[model samples]
Target chain A: MAVDTKKCVGCADCVVACQTENNVPHGFCRDWIVENVKGTYPSLDMKFQSERCNQCENAPCVRCCPTGASHIVEGGIVLVTHDDCIGCGACVEACPYDARYIHPQGYVDKCTFCIQRVDKGQNPACVDVCPTYCLHFGDLDDPNSDVSKALKNRSWYVLAPEAGTEPQLYYLR
Target chain B: MKEELMVSGKHIAEIYPVLHLWHWEISLYLFLGGLAGGILFFAAYFFIIGKEKEMSTTVKWATFIAPLALMIGLSSLLYDLHHKLYFWRLFTTVRFTSPMSWGAWTLLIIFPLSIIWVASFMKDMFPNWNWKWKYLNQFESFVIKYRLPFAWILMFLSIILAVYTGILLSAFNARPLWNVSILGPLFLVSGFSTGLATSMWLSKNDAERRILSRIDIFFILTELFLIIHLFMGFMAGTAVKLEAFRLFMGGSFTISFWIFVVLLGLIFPVTLEILELNGYHVPKWVPPLLILFGGLMFRFVMVDAGQITRFLY
Candidate 1:
């Protein structure tokens, strides 16, 4: 997933869309917006970057999970199997990005990147509902993919590179 | 400098709800795990060196409590899980890279070893009951036949269990307070120290008590040094690490770390023990009990405070 930070308006539509699509617990969301303001008063810079699970390649959550409930499936999407999860909260603590939480239903929960939709050849709910089309979702391996083109044309950064999580989500400037 | 809300030059912040995934249950589990490992190691060592017959009561009690402590600790850990019944899934596969996996595997060996260690002392413990239970005599005879090798194996497993407890927390790199290499040795020493205290409390003879207390002082001194080095190591590390160090300095965990862990746990116990060593006649249970209580507090404070220390902007 690639996010055009400049184009995000902090509308929170994607958050609602994700919650609705995934039936995220009330008072909980699979996605949110990170709003940062730089520079002083009159001349300031505002950055609205949508944030969620980074889908890290070396996911600590997956590595630390004792039951192997937190695992990577097709398209490199990290997911938690509800039945297998003992919900020891080890994965929740192991996550460097703090991307997971214990759901009220008694299991570890986090953004799945809409695996159901992704498997059905559709974009994630957050990307689909993005009003400004700032959120782009596609296979990075495919040269013709939209996310690939965006990466080719724009410079991007991953949050907390020092964490060494190798996050797949990119923020395009 | 006191100006309100006007200056802005890249203010980076994180948004996540207050997480309370682990609580007292986890802390108790850690404490008990180390304590069990420590007891088993010391008990096995005593047996291997041919001192079991002399310290029969201590050996019987220590070996008996070792497995009980581990069982209680494992129970607490399982109780804290969201799907407690599904905990069996942890044993399905072994992942060498995962500390949880290491712990799970270590626990599998630990229980059996502890039972075997305890079995060695069973016949000596309850003769009337042992006479009625043929299986107990058979088990004790078998254990005695293989006592030396079994003792060494128990020692090996105990050491692994002790180190595994520390490495479990240190594996979580996101929490700076728990991500240090020294944690393994620190916990190992802490386990030995607490084990000595337990031995002192359970000692039937004055000579045994005096020897254990003297041995305990070494562990206490080593623990003090390791703790200092732990903080010093953090202070010499990155910004996030320094923030973690503040937990003991003047941060939110300052009071608990200093008052409960440092002063009450290490300093006070060591002082009291030293006084007793110098013929000051301290209370029989005071020093050991204080050390044991302090050990529990150490786990509580470390687990609670470590969870809050994150690598965030």
Candidate 2:
């Protein structure tokens, strides 16, 4: 996953699109827009960054889950198996990004990158509905993939790389 | 002339989440689990060294209390689960990467080992009751025959269990206070100290009481030093890690950490213990009771404070 913050207007369209498409419960969202304001009033700069699960390669939640309930699946996406989750909240504390929540239905929940749509040859709801085409999704492992080309063509960075989570999500400037 | 514009923009706090997941129940579980392991460790160590007869009160009561504490602690854990019915799923597979998985298996072994440990002392525990059944004598003898090896194994498991209580929290790299490497030994020493305090309360003999109290003073001082280092280490860490230290220094958890954990749990008990050791003859129950109460408060503060600190925006 790659996000071009330069193109974001902070309209929150992707946020609504993800919530509606993913059936995110009331008062909860699978994704959100983080508006960062830097510098002084007259010389101020505003940066709008979309935030969600990083899909970490070395996910702490997966390492600490007692029942193997939270695990990595194909495409390196981290997911929680609801039926296997004991809801002990171990993964909740283990997640550094604060990206997971205990669903009202009694399971840990997080963004899945729209696995349902991705499996059916469709982009994630957030990327599909992005008004400015700011969000891009593709296989980074494939050199020909859009995400790969975006990474090659533009300078990008991952959030909290110092955390050593090896997050799959990238921010393209 | 260059103009200095005052920096003013919205600082969004919504990205920082405050989760009330594990609460008092979980804290109680950690406290009791460590206490149980500590009791068994000391009792079994004494029994293996042939001092069992001299410390009858310590061994006799600890044998039963060890298992009882674990049972109650484990029950609290089960009750804390949101998916209580699916608790059995934890046993279907093994994941070395997961501390909770390893903890479940550790508790499973501790349960039966604790039972056998208690049963081995049954002949001395219920003299008249054992005489009523001849088969009971055979069972007792069987347990007694393996007592030496059981003691060694139980000791190993007890230490593991004690350390496991701390590792459980430290494994969560997200919480700065819990992610430190010192928590394991800190918890182990604290567990041993509380166990000694508990024995001091239970034992009637002055000699046993004095010895346990003296040993506990060392443990208490060690705990105090470790706690200071825990905060110092965090303070020297990254900005997010300093947030965890703020929870103790001057944040919402400050009063609880200073008053309950530092003063009541460590300092007060150690002072009373040292005074007694120097022939001041303070009341026997005061120091030990303070230690036990302090231990409980320590867990509550740590569990609550750790959750409030976060890394992500």
Q: State interface RMSD in Å for all models.
A: 5.9, 5.9
Candidate 1's residue-wise lDDT over B1-313, tens digit each?
Answer: 2222322111112225434568999888888888888888888887788878776545667667788888999989888988777788888888777888878899998898788777666556766555357886676788789989988988898888888888889999888899999998888888878877887788778877887788889999999999999988988989889889887889888898899888999999999988998999888899989899988998888888888888764
**Per-residue alpha-carbon lDDT of model 1 for A1-173, expressed as tens digits?**
99999899989898889889999877666778877776667776788888888999989888888878899986789999999898788888888777787777878889999998998999999999999999989998998998999999999999877878889999999
DockQ of 2: 0.52
Candidate 1 docking category? acceptable
Q: Can you write out model 2's per-residue Cα lDDT over A120-170, one digit (the tens) per residue?
A: 989999999988999889998899988888889999998877777888999
> Residue by residue across B199-279, what tens digits does model 2's lDDT show?
889888988888788788888988989988988899899888888877787889988889987898889889988888889
TM-score of each predicted structure versus truth: 0.94, 0.93
Best by TM-score: 1
Kindly give the stretch of ten consecutive residues in candidate 2 chain A with the minimal lDDT sum. Answer: A35-44
**Relative to the unseen true structure, what is the C-alpha lDDT of residue B65 in candidate 1, on a scale of 0 to 100?**
77
How well does candidate 1 match the true structure in TM-score terms?
0.94
- Which 10-residue span in candidate 1 chain B carries the lowest summed lDDT? B6-15
Q: What is the C-alpha lDDT of each candidate?
A: 0.83, 0.84
